[model samples]
Target: MTTHVQLHDRLDYQSVMPLMEELKAITDDDLVIDAGNLRHLGTLPLQVILAAVKQRAARGQTTRLANASDGCVDMLSLFGFTPETLTQPEVWT
Candidate 1:
């Protein structure tokens, strides 16, 4: 089954740890991260998400980032990540 994790408005230092922990605990074969509410994106949370993606990739699982807000898109692009790349770990790696 697919599991969905909704991101909060802010992903700064104050919230990164909990986001990372939540992402790490998801053992679903497929993960759907809802970024529609994201208004800020921190490097730490980005790293956490990437790590989660890579780990899932190693297990032949898949992760998808969905409903990205404009802020989320801009933040990702600032880090040189396109929304398309999140679903394809190999593309980012």
Candidate 2:
């Protein structure tokens, strides 16, 4: 099953906890997307993604992000996380 989190606006500290809960509820291996709707992603938001990635890694699951705004891309690069940022996907669903 795929879990898609469409972040239409700001993705900051306020959004993380609720998203974590939603992600926790997901069963079976799946995908998560902070998709086309996302606009701004602050430092806390980037950290949130990092944390989620680590958590999923621990569980042997995978999470892929998509449609990151240019600002989001800049922020990821600013934080030195560009390598992990999902830009083009081999298979996007």
Candidate 3:
């Protein structure tokens, strides 16, 4: 089964811990991150997302970002991440 984690409007420092815990709980399933509502994407949260993607890849699982908001897309692009790059586990490195 796939586990979905919806990103909130503000993905800042305060939300990172809980989000990490949520990601940890879904280690056994394919993970889908709903990014359509994201307004602010902090560095820490971005790190967490990258870590989750890398971990999933190591476990032979998948992690995907769906419906990315413009803010999310722009922020990712600042780090040189395209939608296609985001799906590749290697990009997290």
Give the winner by TM-score: 1
Estimate TM-scores for all models: 0.94, 0.71, 0.91
Full candidate order by TM-score, most accurate first: 1, 3, 2
How far off is residue 18 in model 1, in Å?
Answer: 0.7
Candidate 3 regions with alpha-carbon error over 4 angstroms: none
Better by TM-score, candidate 3 or 1 = 1
Residue 8's C-alpha lDDT in candidate 2? 51
Ranking by lDDT: 1, 3, 2
Cα RMSD of all models vs. native, in order, equals 0.9, 5.2, 1.3
Q: Which pairs of residues clash in candidate 2, taking residues 3 or more apart in a chain or in different chains?
A: none
lDDT of 1 by residue, 4-54 (tens): 998998998888789888988998899999999999998888888898899
RMSD of 2: 5.2
Candidate 2, 1-93: lDDT as tens digits: 777767657777788787667666766566667656565677766665666666676677777777666766676666655534542222211
What digit string (tens of lDDT, one per residue) describes model 3 on residues 1-93?
Answer: 878889898988998999898888885568788999998889898888888888888888987899999988998898788656886877556
Cα lDDT computed for each candidate against the true fold: 0.89, 0.63, 0.84
Which scores higher on lDDT, 2 or 3?
3
